[model samples]
Target: MGVVDEAARLERAGYPVIHLEKGEPGLDTPAPVKQAAIEALLANKTRYSHSSGLPELRQAVCDYYASQYGVRIDPRRVVVNAGSSACLVEIFLALLSPGDEVVLPDPGYPAYPRFITAARGVPVQAGSAVTGYQHTAELVREHLTPRTKAILINFPNNPTGAVADAAQLAAFAELGPIVVSDEVYHGLEADGCHSRSILEFTDNAVVVGSFSKAYAMTGWRLGYLIVPEHMVTAVTRMHEDLFVGTNTFIQWAAITALGDAATIQRQVREELNTRRDCLLAELPRLGLQLAHQPRGAFYVLVRQWANTGTSAQLAADLLKHAHVAITPGSVFGPSGEGNIRFSLSAPADQIVVAMRRVEKFLVEHPALAPR
Candidate 1:
């Protein structure tokens, strides 16, 4: 967020900075989704519904899972919140006691630990990037202790973009801790393969899903949690107390989003894949090593071979000199040090422009040349 703020400050100062730092879809909300919201508003569906979410939206979620993943879910187990972040906080609050530990992937989303800590839970880091950013059961088991309450996993991950297969999901399920699966990037795989859900392997997990990434509904601020039957009451109660309910018209639109998710997500995935391919092909030629071949999501974490300073310093320098904004890998976690993350949230042409600027900047500053 600091990088974002700094970029914003520069933009406000009239700098034409090329943005490769944001995590949302570069596209606009689909016409169908926006039209649904407008229709709902015109129909006076603005009144608050159940704190858990609109029943139709919840049912849509169930239907989506059934059709997409072959997983049958009870709508009663769905708890909609402002976003997946809210659902995560509510889950942590409902499940964690003070000092209870939640195992998270190192170089993971920086906010995961903060949320766990806010819920008075200890955040333990497991070195996931060591295995090419895969949060395997073996890695997580090594981090577990008696205090470990849950294992948080994000596939089609944020920075790394590495995804796990069903075998891996089953391995995680067998580990005994409650699996908090962040499936927000579910439909955004680059290889055109749909990522598997934890629910497909076991009913013992909690799924954190969002329309933010796959559906291009980031501004809509809608996400949901598919929890186990036993967890519904506690999680929903916590959500109700904190946020009475999500926007009613938005919920109505979400049902529309689900109804036509395949068409919307296909268009999104194709565009993102094009951008991802552009970065993957270009960055390595600039002497930056991709941390791994990202198979999903819209991020590419690259090792900056020339920089002698921290990733944060390199990122800041890039913003200052190249007029390109990228995230410092160090902010994600220790394992992320010495790298930078480029988000494919900009147009392909703009991303190419940013790379050209980076290449020029590196030339002028030969001290940053690869050793």
Candidate 2:
């Protein structure tokens, strides 16, 4: 089984199931963003936009990046899509041939490999969390083959909340291949946490971002991509055929979201930071080993009890017995087999309550703890 089915089956079995499995934002879309979409609908702007994107939204995307990152983005280089996942599909289609190989880090996003396979490209797992989930220049270089086409990076990463610093990013950027940087969790960093822009490192890269995390707009179905000038036409053309541009109404709201991000990000980041601190402090006491203090995003990747068997079985046992639900790290990749990921997107109170039950279960099932 697939990850989604495993989750659905467990949910149907009626566990208390403190859901830490999904990565969606816990908060509702801010009022102004909602209002903007509604107003756009009422204004009859609900028509097909330019296949690349609405010029207005594309410009907003460009302006947002230029002002925030001090990086100049030609509006022509921005391609709006339903989500960054779709953007990934477009890039793969535009760049890779049937036999091309793409390097993706292990314990990385599950969809990366699936998407590459769907696009008829090969996914080469090149990096490991054994080195703190850091994909070094040497490993990336070693993975390079004549067929290698791109390297994918997810910073302030999912399931681990780990962010790559400047030197690490530069190493990948300087590697002679297309770099796809997934920066979806950019603004949701814990206190004093910040992610370096891939734009700052190289021009031979595409940065994928969304309103999902920072603006609490997951269901908004909105994401955009930044491609280098040379690849912009190909990526945009693929999006044109496959996605037909992002929803016009959602684009309107996303523009408003970019404008109002300061107010929304401050409130969301503060809460996520608090939750991260609480979970990090408490999970270890319950006998799980925290691989590290995740400086950004909202996940805690913990080592499963040594003899507790597979990550999937341990996650199943946690849900069935302790009334908690978390993602089995194995779903990400082979290197993730002995770990599980807990999401802090839920409220702190719920996390605390869930931890209590987990602690009790660990005590009763002593074998689930490290020997």
Candidate 3:
């Protein structure tokens, strides 16, 4: 957050900054979703609502799962919050205690460790990178300590864009730590790629999702969590304390958004696929190797195969001179130090221009470019 804040400040100061830093969606909120929110407000549905969110929205969420994934979900297991980021913090607070160690994938989401540390727990970095930026149950097992209380899993991951497979997810679930699965980017998968929910493997798992990416509702501040019946009450209390309740009208609107699955799914699938291809094709020419073709999400982790400077320096150089912004992998964790991440969340035309700028910048700055 601090790094991004600083970058944003510099950008506003007349610098020609092209920020590809955050994993934000480049698309606008679908018309149907925006319409629902407007209608809600016009109808005087602005009062404070239940802390756990509207019952109808919760049921709509359940119906969404059954229709989309063929998985049956009970409304009692769902808890809605202001955003998935908030829900993640609530889950960590409820499930962790002082001296407890939580296993998180190195080079994973930048916020996972921040939340874990806020809960007074230690974040144990498991071997996600040793296996190509992906985590397996065996990796979790190797890092397991008597005090290990929970495991954090994000897929299609943030910086690496690594998606988990069924066998790997199931195996991780069997390891006995409460799994906090972040599925915020589930719908943005690439060609021939599909995302699996951790719920399919175990009820012990907690699933966190958002309308921010798939629906292009960044300002709506809407996200939800799915947990077993036993954990719902505790999570609800944690949510209540943190955020008395979320935006009432937005909650009602999200129900409509969830019900109209076909429209939203089709749009996100098309746009993200196009952007992914644009980035994948152009990145190599900028002197970075793909390392892995991003099968899901809008990010790709690349570094100078010829070994230039650290990723942090590369990212700074790109933003300052090239007028393009990307996240340095070191911010994610130690394992990501050599890599930099680009978000395909930008428009295809903008991405093309950004790529051109990066290529030209690298060619000019031979000291920074790989030999």
Query: By TM-score, who's the top model here?
Result: 1
TM-score of 3: 0.95
Tens digits of lDDT, candidate 1, 221-294: 99999999998888878778889999999999999999999999899999999999988889766888888778
- Candidates, ranked, TM-score: 1, 2, 3
lDDT of 3 by residue, 212-306 (tens): 88888888889999887789788888777778878889997898888886789668878888888888878656656875568787788876434
User: Model 1, stretches more than 4 Å misplaced?
Assistant: none
Q: Model 2: per-residue lDDT, tens digit, 260-286?
A: 888898888898888888888786687
For candidate 3, the clash count comes to 2
Best by lDDT: 1
- The models' CA-based lDDT, in order, is 0.90, 0.83, 0.82
Please give each candidate's TM-score.
Answer: 0.98, 0.95, 0.95
Model 1 / residue 304 / CA error / Å: 1.3
Tell me the lDDT of model 1 at 147.
93
